[model samples]
Target: MKLGILFSGQGAQKAGMGADLYAALPAYRETIDQASAILGYDLQAVANDEAKITQTAYAQPAILAMSNAIINALGDVLPTPVAGLGLSLGEYSALTASGVMDFNQAVAIIKDRGIYMQTVGEANPGKMVAVMGDDQALIESVLAALQAAGKRVYPANYNTFAQLVIGGVAADVDAAVEALTDAGIQRMVELPVSGAFHTPLLKDAALQLTTRLAGETFKATQYPVYSNTTGSVFTADTLFETLTKQIISPTYFAQALQKMLDDGVDTLIEVGPSDTLIKFAKKIAPKDVKRYAITDVDSFNAVRDLLLAEGKEA
Candidate 1:
């Protein structure tokens, strides 16, 4: 049974995400403690407190901490030989799991990254909106009209054939939404994010992160890891440099999942707060592939049972 792990990005966080894992797994608590020491902030508090989870500075580390905690807890039951990929900010957690970056370094980098992005958001007001339903040509046409009108709008994420996200200046984003609505598009919800992530507006943060990443030590991965930047698998040799590039590059999560399928991955597992990635993957992956998400203790147990049942069937 070939397995793959997916990590969540910025918007997937919720309060008390890792509380169960921290209580059930000693290693998880230890990992959180180490992260708190490195970050000089209580990671557990951030996970349990909604106020802290909403702040970018705390959210990034908190999400990363939760992801690491889940993976570590799963370690007691699952092996570490699976392939992995993370979405946007989740890419840092993927690197840590893949052995490209140490846990503490990953935590520190995400903390700095969150702070930088928050600062950028304050300087330039922006917004992101998720557009659902399948109308690729229509969506493109709407975006083009917005751009032709001098609006700073662009497609930030191609989540699925049925889902896309656009980001840019607040006015431009609002205009894009209005245009899409006029075109009869429903389910256009503006995300709660403070900045236009994955777009050129984050260029400054990306550049700053590159410099900080260069100072960190990255080891070769023992397992295959996919790159959200290019939607391709990376070896131990190119992990660090590719991770640095992933900061500014748009995440090709859909493409990455396709690549994983092409590579013969049969079991897809998302290790984080939500099943968003697995949901996306199931929409696009081959019919024979199985999808699993380990978001909380219940989902974790469900996945274990599913895997065991599959084994018995085989």
Candidate 2:
């Protein structure tokens, strides 16, 4: 079966994410240990510490490590994915998985990326709000009007057709929230993040990440991987710029998923913690396209058995 892998992004991480898998699976354990070595500390320890896991610096690498561990745990039976994509921070994990970058370099870069984003966010003091509505046109028009009226709000993430996020300076975001509320939309939730990520407020963070990324070597990808910034597969020429722009741009995740579905990915798996991306897939993908989110041993086995069964059937 053709497969599409979706890696988890930040914000869904919790304390004790992959402890069970680490204890039970040797390959998983080995991968986590390698990440811990590259990171110069216990990656699992950082994950179990609530305060540390919540911090952006620790969370990004920990999540990437967890995603990689799941991939390792899948072992040789795992089918090569035809394509893959990830939300926000998870893009680095996808790149690593697809062989565009080494795992060691990816982990190290993500650590610094978290630090840079958190530092810049603290200094700038902005906010993000998830706007819940099906009317993409209305949401864009409202945000555009606000922008024209000197409010700094921008559409940060296009998660689904029904839901998107907006972020900017705190006051401006609050104003946009009010405006949307007045325009008969009331369901807006402020995200618990330190920075207005995926907006121009994080431009400094993006610049820092660009400089950090320059040191690493990026190889040709094994298979197509969708770009969150472009809502299409990443090309060799556009990889670097797309990665940098992803920091201060709206992530077209819905568009990316549509592209994957259109490209004939019959099976979709969300790797790493949380079922967030899978839920999004459920909304966007056809019912016949098998979708599973593998966060732990049980979920992993379920998907493994399904794939093996499918292979036997074939």
* List of clashing residue pairs for candidate 2: none
lDDT of 2 by residue, 1-314 (tens): 99999999988799999988889889999999999999999999989998999988899999999998898788767889999999989898999999998898898898899899889989998999999999878989998999999888999999988889999999999999998999999698999988888999989999998998786778999999999999988888999999888899999999999999999999899998899999998889999998899898899889889878877887
TM-score of 1: 0.91
Cα RMSD (Å) per model? Answer: 2.4, 1.0
Candidate 1 clash pair list: none
lDDT of each: 0.81, 0.91
Among these predicted structures, which one has the highest lDDT? 2
- CA lDDT, candidate 2, residue 251: 95
Ten contiguous residues with the weakest lDDT in model 1: 73-82
- Clashing pairs counted in every model: 0, 0
- Candidate 2 Cα RMSD (Å): 1.0
Candidate 2 segments whose C-alpha is farther than 4 A from its true place: none
